[model samples]
Target: MKKTAVKKTASRRPRARLKKSPLPFVDPAGQNGLNPEPPRAIFLEQPAVYPGTAPKAPGFELPPDYGDTKIALFAKDPWWLYAYWEVAEPDKAREAIRGLGLAVQRTVLRVYELATDSRAAERVSFFDILVGSTTGDWFIDVGQPDKCWMTELGFVADNGRFFALVGSEAVRTPRFGVSDVVDEEWSFSSELFWKIYRASGRIGAGASSYDVRAVVIESWQESAALQKKQLLLKGEGPSSFQSRGSA
Candidate 1:
């Protein structure tokens, strides 16, 4: 009987919505409305002007200064010498050529052999070479080794007068068949002697031990006789011969 009573509830109300404003009208030809004015333009300020003399025109540049002429020489080998030179100031070279007062056809290289003594003026020999240009290199043949040499670059005048421009330092040629550093004495070791003897084929492949020994003894005796003969031919006295033979 208590479940038969039921309570009644009130109904809910819906909220009210606000309306949006309309957009402005636009013309397709870029004119929003009638009597529209054109847009104004902005520009940067100009540079200031000074009333005075005009700028000068650039002139031609001058030539650069150069160094003096130089010469050098070196020994290429026992019988050859190499010489080279450079003419830095060509104007000076031209002036000298003009001063020669001759029909200059070639540049001349004069080589001289100096004495062993440094302070001596005794020239052993002299020679000349003719070239087309002032600046060049040359390989000279100075025959006979072990000598001091000097050289100069110049031009020969019509009257045969030599006009020297540059000179090189003294250079010495090497000796023949030997180096500057000499050994007092030289000898072969027993091991090296045996190697050389075997390589010389004195003992054949089929030789026995006794046969090898006999061959070696015979070779030693022959070599000793030859050496003694050579010493006698070279004017060795009997005392020296006896001393060497005993040793």
Candidate 2:
């Protein structure tokens, strides 16, 4: 009994570690302290900012600067707009030109529903109008758009003269199924743009898609900027683009 001594051993304990939850972003149940879960912020909770009236479009008569006016944005979020009145005629045409551009400008200033489907029918909540003269290049926008939608309807001359436009800002998340960030350029070639344009019909009534030039569209793994830059240099549409001449 004196020759052998009892050996002592330490008790083992479990270590604390955080693991990925099956429900995503949720902590495992019944762990340590019971902290209440934080609530999510809702964007739709805010009241929409829209005027009660819709600005009227000019009739079939085409003004002198109908398609030639230049719109320059001198500020961010673009508040101050400088409209260059380069009318071809004397006084009356200039007045009509100013009036027409002003009306279009007012409409563009306010956020309009650029989606064709009834607001309730579609999942989309809201949209803003981006009139042609509102941006730098005389199109919707010349750079990559963060979020947006387009509609089949647009502002125009009563004689069927068309005015270019884009829709309001969209909510951002990893949610858009067909959109790639870097693959987006100022032009509409991305799947996101096509889908929105196709559904919304940003094109004016009865206009042909044949006049719409294609831009190099990059897929999920492609570079949108590079493709657009290349298209800009080449003055050609994408490889898959087909001319919708009659259809």
Candidate 3:
């Protein structure tokens, strides 16, 4: 009975100790383990330059004068006429005018105010502009609107004889005001004209007739208020000067 089985406490088996091998020495920055490999070298390909990618050179210059004997005229607005002419070179001019016994002294632009639109119309008046030998262009002020004009590029002789070298075709200027020639089929009355004139003002729907009248009056007054410098003599008003080769 005393031999009571000493409850033998079951001894738990000891766990096996894992002996881990020493860890590899890491870099201070921890980027690589103990034996850090050398860094790799990267290569990049450069783009090729093409001939078309280069900048272009400056443009070619135009000749100042063509060795041709020609003249051109153009109308600028209702007041001015522009004329450009190219005479033959000195040698050519002399050769062409040889045996003419015309001793050229100076260049002159003879502006003729014609009576009609015909190229051979009767000359109503004439004026001369003394352009030096080297002038290639000129501006002529006829000072009369709705007239025909022709210009002649000629050399003035030392003895006052004018030798015409080249003449331009007659060009009629545009009428500055309303044309006098009315169509018989379409009679434009003064009332219609005034109506159109008022409509051109674009008066608002709510604008009264008095407002329209005021607008018309203001416009009329403004037109009448001319500057002293703009006032020409009785017949010296600017004509319709048009360029050549135009209708």
Candidate 3, 1-247: lDDT as tens digits: 5776778889999999999999787787766746567789997798777989977788998787887777777676577788988776654554445557656777888888888987699999888999875338987886677788888888777678777777788887777898889774345446655665656565433556676677666655554454322554333334322322244
RMSD of each: 20.2, 27.4, 20.4
- lDDT of every model, 2 decimals: 0.74, 0.38, 0.72
Q: Which number leads on TM-score?
A: 3
Model 1, residue 65: distance off in Å is 14
Model 2, TM vs. native: 0.15
Q: Which ranges of candidate 1 are over 4 A from the true structure?
A: 1-68, 93-105, 117-121, 179-247
| Candidate 3 lDDT score at position 199 | 60
Could you arrange the candidates by lDDT from highest to lowest? 1, 3, 2
Error of 1 at 91 (Å): 3.8
**What are the per-residue Cα lDDT tens digits for candidate 2 across 65-98?**
5544332222122122122222122234335645
Lowest lDDT 10-residue stretch of candidate 3: 236-245
Models ranked on TM-score: 3, 1, 2
- Residue pairs whose backbone atoms clash in candidate 2: 60-159, 128-168, 150-200, 151-200, 151-201, 151-202, 152-200, 152-201, 183-224
Off by over 4 Å in 3: 1-57, 95-102, 187-247
- Give the lDDT of residue 24 in candidate 1: 58
TM-score, predicted candidate 1 vs. hidden true structure:
0.44
